[model samples]
Target: MIPTPEIRHVNVTRYITPLREGGSLPAVADADDGFKYVVKFKGAGHGVKMLIAELIGCEIGRVLGFKVPEVVFAHLDEAFGRTEADEEIQDLLKGSQGLNIGLHFLSGAINFDPVVTTIDAQLASEIVWFDAFMTNIDRTFRNTNMLMWHRELWLIDHGASLYFHHSFTNWEKGAQTPFALVKDHVLLPQASELDTANQKLKSLLTPQVLQDIVNLIPQEWLEWEGYEQTTEEIRAIYFQFLTARLAQAEVFTKTAQDARKALI
Candidate 1:
């Protein structure tokens, strides 16, 4: 069994206010290092679900070779006075007080927009495709959890995905399970532009890289009591996803290459 990360105590001198707020996970603050990390509390409430979802989503993003913020789960040791349900959440908060949860901080360095481009359409298409393959449903126009840095698109906030697993009783991983999203998603911004981008991804998302990405996730994170089963299940699903995606990649590559030639 892998050991859990050593929980640490932190002194957040100044609580940098959020640029925006709402949703289960609130945007916390950008630290002195210039990286803006979102601080979210874990308790016997809705935020619990969000925290779990985000951890899973980021792991998936890492596998697909996207720039996800370095996520470290930690506890908020500081006091913010009191809120409405303060007493009820206190124990869980105290238990979590130096213990980790999901992402610890957000780097304010990078920012991105799905509707806009300083980022190439091909790269954007891959980001969308990656999200689709991972079953991420949060990157829509209303709440695109992505960032733009150095004119590059950085993907984030995947805590809203794999809902089928969350509500497994209501949803089945049927034949439609695999490519269902691919057909409907269509790699936003059109396939015509993304044709060339796929080629770049072929090299970037090699099998070794995929394995390494999965390895980056601490084993303890997957071992969380209730989530372990789903973690293994998702791992298997992703294995199949990667194999199928890559098996057809050669053909897809050829198609893209041909499409690129036609455009010229």
Candidate 2:
């Protein structure tokens, strides 16, 4: 079994500023650990599910040897919101006066522009396969949520992946559903070694590794209504969905390959 990642907890020292690029209004905050973090609030319009996705997606990326920013659990006190003058910001902080998600701020990181930067075909294929396996739909040409730091690509803003959890009514059936949209992936044309990537990466995501990743999610974040199962049971459901997807990895791999071929 892979070593479980140690998720450090830090207190919000100060609210630096709001990142306005996205609708959720994530912020750059100074934490007690003397580090700046891009904090994703629990009270955002997207709710806690996004936080769950961010944790799981980033963890999965890390396991696959992708450059993902360090994710930590940030603790916010109600007092932190009292100093914010903006009503919206204050409300968000007040509501998120508990555990939240934070990505370690990478200074001097530039947004990855595909037009300006050329990516290695092997790495591109691995990323494509990874995104396809996760059923991530956010990595498109228009808004690639990636950064280039020290000339290496770093993935960010994975709150939109793992969308199956949003509607768990038929999650089992949905697990095996084809990711037909992989054709739209921005990196599809550059993914020239998907079969090799699939063979190498798929072996790393054993059932134990997936379970270890799911276990990292805080219990409070797992609570959801409209599901008959308890919180732990719901967690188990996630494990099942991921394993089931792994079993059908070839289907998604083929979908991506076919999509890439069509684009040629």
Question: Could you tell me the TM-score of candidate 1?
Answer: 0.58
Clashing pairs in model 2? none
lDDT for 8 in candidate 2 is 93
lDDT of 2 by residue, 133-174 (tens): 888989999888999999899999989888898777888777
In the range 1-264, model 1's lDDT, one tens digit per residue, is 123223233433333543344444253543434444665555434444455556656755665567776676544564632342545334544444443443455445454444454455656567655554456666655666777655555676766665554544423342124433333332353444554555555565556555544444334444445543566665554444454555555444444445434544
Candidate 2 achieves a global lDDT of 0.90
**Per-model TM-score versus the true fold:** 0.58, 0.97
* TM-score: model 2 vs. ground truth: 0.97
